[model samples]
Target chain A: MKVVDIYRAIADSTRRTILDELCEQNDQTLFEICARLTNNHGLGLSRQAVSQHLETLESAGLVKSRKEGRFKFHQIDSTPLDEITARWPADASRSSPDASRTTKRASTETEEQS
Target chain B: MKINWTSIFVTDQQKALDFYTDKLGFVLKHDIDMGGPRWLTVVSSEEPDGVEIVLEPNSHPAVVPFTEALVADGIPMNQFAVDDVEAEYERLSSLGVTFTQEPTTMGPITTAVLDDTVGNLIQLVHQDEGAQG
Candidate 1:
């Protein structure tokens, strides 16, 4: 499967909700996802609409669908989402951008001295 | 008027009869010969005189596509009430039945979807007490 932009995949509110539902329960059928969207989240989306959302998530490697026997089940793969935080990690103590810039400069200077 | 019977389209009548009676424990209520496709129906063993489920043949051109789409999405064509869904899930699983969805609670109801093996999904549901709507 070709991986697409994770940000684009998660941009839609419905797609994010799909991920949320899968997080609560790992493996879910398309029907179960639709039911929860309507009942729990009050989003009455058509099955085709949900299918398209799933396709988008699949392209981003955020979801994986497995064909087991006659039915197909979907499971979330949040590993691809790890790239987002890896690109810009969260720091608890850093209050300003200058502090992070100084830390990066110090690390670069140490690398140069070595 | 009371609903005496509800129908589910099955790929084969004999296979549906076997699954419904032998596997699901529904007692055979009627087996009248209606020409090519027999008027086959079955009732729950617990309620022999209750509503009968008609296992109609999916010979219609439109029925196959309709059922196929539903099955593809893990949608159950019909639902049956059970006292305990998890217990039934165990019982049915032991009987070589294929379940697409396990018992999951949503508010007051717990439901599990399983393949009927006749081109339709059947849901076994258990509702919590005092939560009737």
Candidate 2:
């Protein structure tokens, strides 16, 4: 799968939450994911819907699943997130000049509008 | 204290990435394998270290209905600042990017809206340099 697919997998808030659940407690089943989402986040989603979301995340390489007899377990793999944090240099000063200029202009406009 | 990352929902990740990088001129900032789905992100060439835009998948049960409502209403999921909206519009148009709203000056900012091809409308904006402090 391409890198873009990974981005697509975590874009949705629900999927992110699912990832978070897996992160908090790795190797969970579909029923567990749904339970946590509803109990903790107040997001009442159907088992089928949550299953589909898991499939999307799985296809993107964010979620991994393994079958243990009759139960399927899902887990979160966070290796891909490193790439996102690594994209920029640690120093904020390394940001391009265009960004600063735009920020300055935006602030100036806000002041003028006020 | 600062906004570092933001994302928009897309119907398809690969298609969104191509349009964003090839047509919109963003650079791929990150793409890594996470065992199941890869972690992917992009940044503006002008601000590689600034805010990162994530092309998130709209696969959640709630995303489809919400995104559809936004699309039906012609609302842009997010906005990006450009040096010149008209010039960017022309460049993207040449690349076959479809715009729902052409560049039009609205007070101090000139803006245009375009289809992101991933189930969202994205806006490109320009602020006159001369108006800056």
* Best candidate (score: DockQ): 1
Ten contiguous residues minimizing lDDT sum, candidate 1 chain B: B100-109
Q: Give every prediction's interface RMSD.
A: 1.2, 19.5
Give candidate 1's error at residue B67 in angstroms: 1.0
Q: After superposition, how far is residue B93 of candidate 2 from its true place, in Å?
A: 0.7
Error of 1 at B133 (Å): 1.1
Best by TM-score: 1
Model 1 per-residue lDDT tens digits across residues B1-133: 9999999999999999999998899999999997789999999999989999999999889998888878878999789999999999999999999988888887788899989899999999888888887
Q: Which stretches of candidate 2 lie over 4 Å from their true place?
A: A1-114
List per-candidate RMSD values in Å: 3.9, 26.4
Clashing pairs in 1: none
